[model samples]
Target: MPLSGDLTGDGRISPMRSTAVGIRSTRNPRLEVPLGPFRPPGLSLTRGRAGFGSLVLIGALALSMSPAIPATTVRDQEVAGVATTGGEDPGIVGDSGGYATAVAQAHPHPNPIGRTDPGGVAARAVVPAVVPVVFGPRTDETTLRRVRTIRGQIRPKSVVASGAGLVIADNMMYRHSVTIYDTSGALIRTVKDRVTLAALGWPDFPTPVSGAPVEAAMSPDGATAYVTNYSMYGKGFARPGWDLATPKDRVDDSFVYRIDLASGTITGAARVGAVPKFIAASPDGRWIIVANWASWDLSVVDVATFREVRRIPVGPEPRGIAFLPDSRAAYVTTQYHDARRGYPAELYRLDVGDWTLEPIRTDLGHFPRHIVLDADGRYLYASMTGDVTVIKLDTTTGKIVASVRTGAAPRTIALSDDGLSLYVVNYDDDTLVKVGTADMRVLQRLATGHHPVGVTFEPSTRTVWVACYSGTLMLFHEEG
Candidate 1:
């Protein structure tokens, strides 16, 4: 079915019309897709066995008439179950192999403070025209090299740099919900996600509910940390959130826990949209923005009140978010590919002041998962799972200046404090790649544990931390 109208901000499916492309959904609860008006072309829906046979015939006919769809059409299916294999030696790339670099022309009205007019003239008219560029790596010197690996029952989905000179591994419903490590890779403590919602302001009923931690963000002072729960596993949560679920599913809402870093205690909790994934705190420490994967929107939480202030609809499967240095704007990645547009995905720029969004068009391939900003906030580095490459964009001009192929299924990315290097993990390849930001060159690559899904750069120790889904953590240190 083709998605027809706008989402209603609440976790409900929008109007959809059946007709066009065929989409096979996964059985994984965490990998649900949003329901839209995507209609399979030339296929008719029926309730009986005869209708099923007719549907198959129509699908086969449509496939024969059209070009084969790329394997990336189904998110993560390409590498989800693939074996972790690697034989490449760590080395630096010298050039992009003559691949083209896409550059987006600057819009006439480049004012950053502009709002989305009611007519959407600012949103539509100011859309930059992006020139297609060949996706590959540019060159730089190697600095970060593999140091060691820490293995155990830690099934981490993401690793974050807590401001207090610590690294946090978010273990989603694993043995431990979160694991804390010092910059030197020493285990500090493990915190469970079980909390009393009534104590945190939800007074309807009191019960000890456990949360499946997915991602986390630290406050400016590092005194506090906010972690997103993939799902709640106790009372008050009836319908679980799915990774590939539509709004119509009306999945149970999740919560973000505010933790006191010193005591490692969940001090507060705020309800948010379903399946909240990537999260970030504004530079000025005024607000916390969460990218709700299933809800296709953002929950803005006020730091002072520790409550969700507003929920704004972005697009389907909003995954990554990066705020500007001044806390005036944020960049979000809606990684869901739209079959109707026949394009990969979209990136949006949110006006923090007014809660308005402007879609930034790009040729970056499907599933742009993780994004990070440079120290100066002038350039943005994004990891594209579909393209298996990382592209750098000039924030002021909105141009794809450079790109480099890392490996298959590059997930989380981290930028060096000095803004000279970038670290990315290749989930399918089971490798960590260090790239020089100056030219988007591959500085070095190293074999990691199975399914290295998350990476973070620790400045205090100048070391790189990686979280592997195979219950291991890899650490890389800078020799320079």
Candidate 2:
């Protein structure tokens, strides 16, 4: 299986390198590379042999020219926007002309506030894996009410809240491989990422393998959680993945483990490309997309078959991903700036129906990492490592509408249930910042543990959870 590179822009393709079979060491900190001259050697635009489609085509997008947005000068100052009622239009402009109607028909589901159910298994159904949060009236102010800290022998790279009342922290090969907690910030169980691949249908090696869990995404129904491994350790694997890996690196492929939330066991594993970082289940629950860091491609796995259906080549170091509410499109962020080609941090949008990839140029600054869209898919928020801030983008027009100065190295972000409050974790600053979407102002900022990399919002308690790489899980409650 040679690597394909027709879409890497350099037009250089290379054959796959053989793995030097052995278990490799696991490290925690995801590299935050400095901006410099770096050129990607290749990109794999090939679909998987499972055959969703083999025809690889890159379409040039003719995006309408929009005025270049001036650099945001406002930092924490509140720049208010026009107020509107619950059903009134936000007046967001562009191609999503039906935004108002969509917002009107959208019924905001009241979060199960005090539910203590860990989570009940529901019959598997083919529905959207993720339901977009509906925007509600933002009349109430948000403030940090209290903070709770959960300490253990762990180095959490990320924490994900399964809207059904559970939160999982991927401990990145630490003593506790992964930690599970209830919505009330209590520990449920700590699971080790040790699994026998043969039992999961991989007959190549019958022995047990250990994976360094990086990030996780839950299925729409909340019955299952998909966790991506930074690298697999044990038999039949070699060459550990590096954070700043390039095409020249001969890294081994990784796996995405399927955790049955009810049973809390690793039920299945899908082999994906090297250094899989971010994983997301599509809203329609038909696919799971994994961003392969070293391989510079995406593994689009079919949920029904539990196998990769497509391997779409993206640019180097793809980190963050966000999908549209209708599951019609997915927006992926590539962190690497192709200085050789004069390209800044690039954002690619994949059309789900046709699997065509196109770059959506925006003036949202450099090193775009995590991204999240509003309920109506009108506004997109992305954290920029280069800018040390988060910019709000008008998705329809691909222009930065508003921005706020988040602290240095803002890693992951979480949007509130009502889509009115955005939570961001500054890894370098060891703090979490809450921003009001209406005015793009910092509502509050609270100190966190060391290297706070992951952040998530729990709708049940309306609390915020932050995962620190230095063994801490901090929970914060929002008060008016």
Candidate 3:
């Protein structure tokens, strides 16, 4: 629970404060890892600092951006018995003390994308290969002070910002909830619902139910936040054996819950493919696109109506996705760690105009995990896990330009809004890495908490927020 920030967007608002920005649960569903080609046992999948210091914000959420439509209603979800326990204060540091973990190439997480096993399978590769190398920004590391931490969930996946005062933390493992925080990093809402599973078409729910929420994206206007529900609560219709959830795998169709940030309501819920992992909106806010892991497709929804426009088929285990600045093309990365199918993971390119999906010739080898495009949309980056590297790809030529070596297992990859730097979350070593997008060099590699799963960039404050699977959100800001 490393809290950072001063409750303002560029130091304009009052100091941090908290009010009951109440949200009601509408009950919805929800949905990690890194690993290899030849294979390992427990492999699994899935940025920045002032480089905000002694900074802490305490106040009600307030934003300076243009508001989107207010949520007429919100879908609140709740897990039966999940609670938040605070972490011991580790004492603050100023751009100091974290250690960089080298690539051991040893003991990679077996569970790709955070699940037990896709159970081995031979995967098909339909494109040519293109490997690239990432070079400079060999910039140094700057450590930020640990000012505060949140104790609301067990394994928080990712924290999303809306250019407003509120940020949402998607909790994966226990509690299946999303913790909402003000820009100052104070917890405001934990979204969960107690709906009867029967209503969601699941006859089971012999008891009241809740959902496991994963990744989220906000509309351009900052009024609505879209969250992906990974799985359902109360029972095991997911598998044949009768057991609670041990491996963290879900079998049912997931959902996307829309929330009106300002009103604090879980506005609506829409069904998508199974195990929905990542979500993003078109630049114009016309559609909300979701990547469904188990379903092997993308769910495109009408933003204003929340209706499914199409369920576009992708390969398997699709993880991270990003749209070009013009919203013309989207790139998705897949974890080829499926043992049964044995499909080599790859990066798929979807042409927005024609709605066509084709694999991008990538040098990421057999397993590519995450992706993000530059603000200019000329180059795109992907975390090539099986190869233990991050690559910068040329969108025009569909070839690699450069590749940078990373720690044991690299999960998620993000870029600064200016596309000047890349931040990667290396899960196995609990490390956060920063690289200069310009030179393709490793700038900073700092240690994080146990199993860090999610990393998000807040351009408004030039801040980086890291969420740990063990329940903590650490904040950092770029220094001059």
Kindly list the per-residue Cα lDDT of model 3 for residues 28-133, writing each as its tens digit: 0111331112110010111111112222111112222222211111112221221222442322221322210110011111111221212111121111111111
lDDT of each: 0.62, 0.64, 0.53
Error of 1 at 444 (Å): 0.5
Q: So what's the TM-score on candidate 2? A: 0.73
* TM-score of each predicted structure versus truth: 0.70, 0.73, 0.66
- Per-residue accuracy of model 2 over 275-326 as CA lDDT, tens digit each: 8988877766677889998887889987766788889877667877887766
Off by over 4 Å in 2: 1-140, 339-345
In terms of lDDT, the best-performing candidate is 2
TM-score order, best first, reads 2, 1, 3
Question: lDDT order of candidates, best first?
Answer: 2, 1, 3
What is the Cα-based lDDT of residue 195 in candidate 1? 88
